[model samples]
Target: MGRSRGGYSTKIHVSVDGLGNPLELRITGGEKSDITQGEELIEGWQRKDTKVIGDKGYDADKLIEKIGEAQAVIPPKRNRKTQRHYDKHLYKERHLIECFFHKLKQYRHLFSRFDKLARNFLSFLYLVSALFWLK
Candidate 1:
């Protein structure tokens, strides 16, 4: 989602790997924090073999520490009170996730939240991802 007169718009909670491929997508209330949705987005098998990269917004101590075998490559937020170590070079590669979102939203079905149910919306997003692979 993009910025608007109403303030920052909707946040698409996309979970991507170190290479920036979308593994999961979740729609939340526009005001939600990226870190708040991180765990739910990265749970189970998909997270078993990956190094997750995200910006400072996902700098929660809990999430940074607990992603199963996957490493949370998120840097510490500016105001964080502790000395946290993160891989800067790895974080740079995170732009792939951004590009994925940009491409994902190009599909008309995913540009807006038209479905009333979360499952339906998720299915549309998956369809959008599938269509991208078809190109």
Candidate 2:
């Protein structure tokens, strides 16, 4: 369980294409570090021209080195001494993925973890995702 000032929550990590279509998803306790699943999210989906874009939470040396080998647009954390360069223009496109999350939350059942079991929650998530794709 992950708890913060807001109380217990979970983090839904996602990988999306340039078009804003979700390619993959993973759920973890909110306390979990985003970098832990960063590499796995791009595993087999990586391509030569693929550029992985992420927020400051995904900033890490190993993840940067791993995805940077292909093309990474991840911004360095503000606290980093050696700041990394990223294309602000490309990073702006990250809003597409954020919008997708907002859309998913539109479904009342998904707005909260009504289903206690992870399997049940994930199943509903897949169903909701399919609906999004159909739209």
Candidate 3:
């Protein structure tokens, strides 16, 4: 879930490569925690050890543990006085996700909450993602 002028906009979280190609995507409520959706997206999908990257929103300890060999490059959230560590260089790769969202929002079905059911919305989301991957 990401904050926007429309308030908390529902995000269809996705994992992509350097080219912004979709590998997996999961729809999350506008107010849901990013860490809550992390493992769910990767379960049964990871083919090998992978590297996960995100902003401070995915900085939960449990989510990091679940990812195993896949390193999390999540930055520490501000206002957390406690000092923490992350891979600064690797985290730069998170731009891929930003690029992916930019492309996704270009689609009408994806940018707006038109479908009544989550399943239907997810179906459209998947269809769009498939098309992105095909190109």
Best by TM-score: 2
lDDT of 1 by residue, 64-124 (tens): 6677577667888788789689888878888888789888767766676666566776788
Candidate 1 is scored at a TM of 0.76
Clashes of each: 0, 0, 0
How many clashing residue pairs, candidate 2? 0
Task: Give the candidate order by descending TM-score.
Answer: 2, 3, 1
Model 3 clash count equals 0
**What's model 2's lDDT at 43?**
82
Better of 2 and 3 by lDDT: 2
Better of 1 and 3 by TM-score: 3
lDDT of 3 by residue, 1-135 (tens): 345676646767787876889888788777777778877866754334677777787777777677677766778788777757888988888888898888888988767777757788889888888888789
Q: lDDT of all the models against the reference? A: 0.72, 0.82, 0.76
RMSD of each: 3.8, 1.8, 3.4
Give the candidate order by descending lDDT. Answer: 2, 3, 1
Better of 1 and 3 by lDDT: 3
Q: Ten consecutive residues with minimal summed lDDT in candidate 2?
A: 1-10
